[model samples]
Target: MDSPPFESFSRVLSETIGPLFVSAIIGGALQGVIGGQAIYYFKYNKADPLVMKCLVLFVWVLNILHYFLVVDAIFIYTVNGHGDPSSVSRLTWSDIAIVLVSDTGDLAVKSIFSYRVWRLSRQWYLSVAIMTGALVTFSFSLYLTITMIQSPSVMPNAVGTFGALITLAISDIIMSVILAMVFWKRRSVFPTVNRVLRMVILYSLETSLVTR
Candidate 1:
């Protein structure tokens, strides 16, 4: 029999593995904060050995996911496309699914940090409000991701790119505000939260350079 059609091959790669990689990177890093926080909390409190051990395991898993995400994105966007826009056609549904999952993972990470703030200051109201806002932001991101992929003709479109950038910028601002609040509410935890935010901002700047 003749080889399967181009569409079938494209569908297989884009749908099956594309999301896996993108989510791996995006989700992995977001979840990594959760893992890292757990580790630090247990260590500082001198918690049960079981909990400590589990944190270590989680760290490894999240790190692995981050690594795979990088590999997958590069492969799909560059190697597979082979210097031709025609090489990559429609955005498989999987692409949209990956973006949604990754963005949700981001919200989760933010909530986890906000909860940490609550623990530090017992500011339940602030934590709940921030968490709700984060959810809304992620929901919008998910919708935009779906729309962009569903309409492949919009790829590299200025409107879509701006939408994504605006969402991310808002997210970064929210994260910064949370960090500032945490820093002010509990001076003791300032160093930790501030350090993380600094690294996050620096990485974002570096990534922007590469993208440009």
Candidate 2:
């Protein structure tokens, strides 16, 4: 039996660029969801504050740019590199940029949701803490990006990045727990709207976990 041609080449490409390729596909698909939500908000949310609308638009823009960067990274490794697997190991500007864009978008989203928490419960402390965690997460991502630029490896030491992710997850869990409790208490206060409050409690926790 003859050996298959390009077997080693295929393995190298799969190992080096597989995750990025898959991530870009998933991210592109989610962009459609995000776009739909943005469109609905713009069409139906005339009563929203100008600042709020602007913030939403800003986040949407960041998400779009991030998606582009992700695609550009794939192009850089696969297309631009002439299908050379070793090209994936060389970090590109798009790779570094995606990190900053992603982190900034996350911070913006957390700040918006934290404001919602404040509006519902008037708990300044919790909102502040969540924002603090988001900031910390962004800071760590920035550090990781810088480290990637300085290091030789495509995936650099990510301890700070991982710690930031853990902190962000904890913050989300804490926020959801507080939100559920607040909603639960309100269920007793407004008996007629109890069902709606209970649903909100479930939704908040479910969304938090799903995002995590």
Candidate 3:
């Protein structure tokens, strides 16, 4: 007898594709928030230079592209591969291609933030360290993206995944600590100034934690 409709999809969801689908859904929702914010910024952003606006638009474009890719990826598994149980095991071009967009966006944001940090602290060493961390992440992502493109059926390497996570964790820790120290060094004698700086440090730490 032929299997019932959605049976394969149900199985995949129950077994393998559930987490990915949930993540995609969450990402789509976040993208909506980003789109709204982008629109708001464009409407009210009179002070930002033209170049900065363009940069924001570019990043927003990447986010939109990533959202579509995520949708397409799920669509391929649920709609295109509807009857096949093994389709979820195989990687699609979308899966491999997403790394490029995601990594490029991440690198751009990190580079911008690190550049600003360098401007504020004038710390060449901290900038270099952050850049080096970003480089490690980009290298691993590029390698994985290429490897998957060449062999779509190949599963991700454990060592590569671990290395990437470790590099990211180390980088975030360094960034959080270095930023706190930099701000702390600028502490003022006034209680109010010190309180504001402490709040900034706390916010920075919290932001890093979220990214981590």
Best by TM-score: 2
CA lDDT scores, all candidates in order = 0.59, 0.81, 0.79
Once superposed on the true structure, which residue ranges of model 1 sit more than 4 Å away at CA? 1-67, 92-98, 156-164, 187-212
> Taking the tens digit of each residue's C-alpha lDDT, what string does model 3 give over 1-212?
45754575577667756777888889978987998999998999878678667778888998888878878888898889876867877888888778878877776666766776787799888888887887888788787777777777778765655666777777777777888988999999899999999999999899888877
TM for every model, in the order presented, reads 0.53, 0.83, 0.81
RMSD in order of candidates:
8.5, 3.3, 3.4
Please tell me which model should have the higher lDDT, number 1 or number 3: 3
Q: Which ten residues in a row have the lowest lDDT in candidate 3?
A: 1-10
Q: Which candidate should be chosen as best, given lDDT against the real structure?
A: 2
Candidate 3, residue 212: CA error in Å? 3.1
Give a tens-digit lDDT track for model 2, residues 9-95: 577678756887898899899999999999999999999788778889999999999989988987887788864645755778888
Ranking, TM-score, top scorer first: 2, 3, 1
lDDT value for model 1: 0.59
Counting clashing residue pairs in each candidate, in order, gives 0, 0, 0
Rank list by lDDT: 2, 3, 1
